[model samples]
Target: MPIIRLMLVFLVFKSVLSGVYGNNSNSENDSKVLQMLIDCGGSVTSLRNELQDMKDKLERLRSEAATDTYIRWGRSSCPSGATTVYDGFAAGSYYTHSGAAANHICLSKKPKFNYHYSNPYKSSYIYGAEYQTYESIWNNLHNHDVPCAVCHIPRSSVIMIPGTDDCPENFKEEYRGYLMSGHHSHTAATEFVCVDGHPVTAPYSSKTDKDGTMFYFVRAKCGSLKCLPYEEGKQITCAVCSYSP
Candidate 1:
């Protein structure tokens, strides 16, 4: 099946800041908290720490609210003691074989605009992403406008959906949102270009976007090496292969 189920994989990242509270919304309580942090000169990191506590509480509530989601879609047991939690997170960011997305980053006025890798493998789930993904949301994490599709997948053992399987919790998308990243090898799945040259990405062991628009060469008829996702500034297209893993 096309990767429709998405897993709420737990991903961990470096603690630069705790979390950004949504203050502009109708929640007066949230507005007060944001003002308090700003007035107290709380560093973004420190504020996020405080906000994280709130998230933890919310997570508990969310977990309780959707207890069946964990049981149904979450991993109940690892197969033959496979090591989960790559780098303390069940999920994290990765470059896919034919995946395309804008990497959020921070920009200092540079004499020239160019793209260079910080070293793709060296990219971390939390800290490094601050430059490419989170921070890049709108230059220095200032703009809170980001829209993305949140796809959930079930546990590793449960690849295909059975007739009786339940769906995972539906998370409300935020202007600035949360993602389970830590997926280094997941995006590296063995995707291939068709003989007709259309990009064909394989299903991830964990999860993948069902909406095929994320892959650059998805519909393009480029067989084998003839298929290449056209890369643009601050955005890119690539393939993911899981064959080696």
Candidate 2:
């Protein structure tokens, strides 16, 4: 009987503390909502309803985009943007040996993508260019389509650069470490750029001959109209980006 009385007293004390700490239905519900969000995957319909509600609220403020903000690029935005002006599929993939040709999507703002995946560098087959194809996705934007095609793709095809058996003598340890660290994105080489200026080039060497060709897999980096699209195999340089070399 004494133990039971103590247990009841503890429960009452706990309730009193909770009340003193400003407990309310709204706060409780909000906490429940947050937990629901954390456990979001299991409740598809509820999530969809929540998303739809968000979309409805968003539409009141912005122009109605054809796709949801979180929707995959090509799945909805790409074709939707392309079809906003034209009548055919623009960003469809079909066993691509190379990505779209002569496209550039670099701009101050990243246009909606057909597909976006985080940490794309380690995923061998994924390729996202520094620019998206403005011409292809023009209808989706209010501004002039700069018509750039920076590709972001995952490339797993193993075409080894034949000449590269060792690292360059002056290759910065920081750059090498950057690669070894499994961080996919390399920057303006503020940290370290290739001596030859092609950071993603093949064989880790500037040398390109019949035995091996330098291959560059691309990723989508931040840029603006300054970036113009080139073909998948087309060699680009500081001059091509209009660096005034």
RMSD of each: 28.7, 22.6
The TM-score of candidate 1 is 0.15
Point out where model 1 deviates above 4 Å: 1-43, 69-245
Q: Which stretches of candidate 2 lie over 4 Å from their true place?
A: 1-14, 17-52, 55-81, 84-234, 237-245
Whole-structure CA lDDT of model 2: 0.27
TM-score of each: 0.15, 0.14
> Per-residue lDDT tens digits of candidate 1, residues 64-92?
44311111111222222122221111121
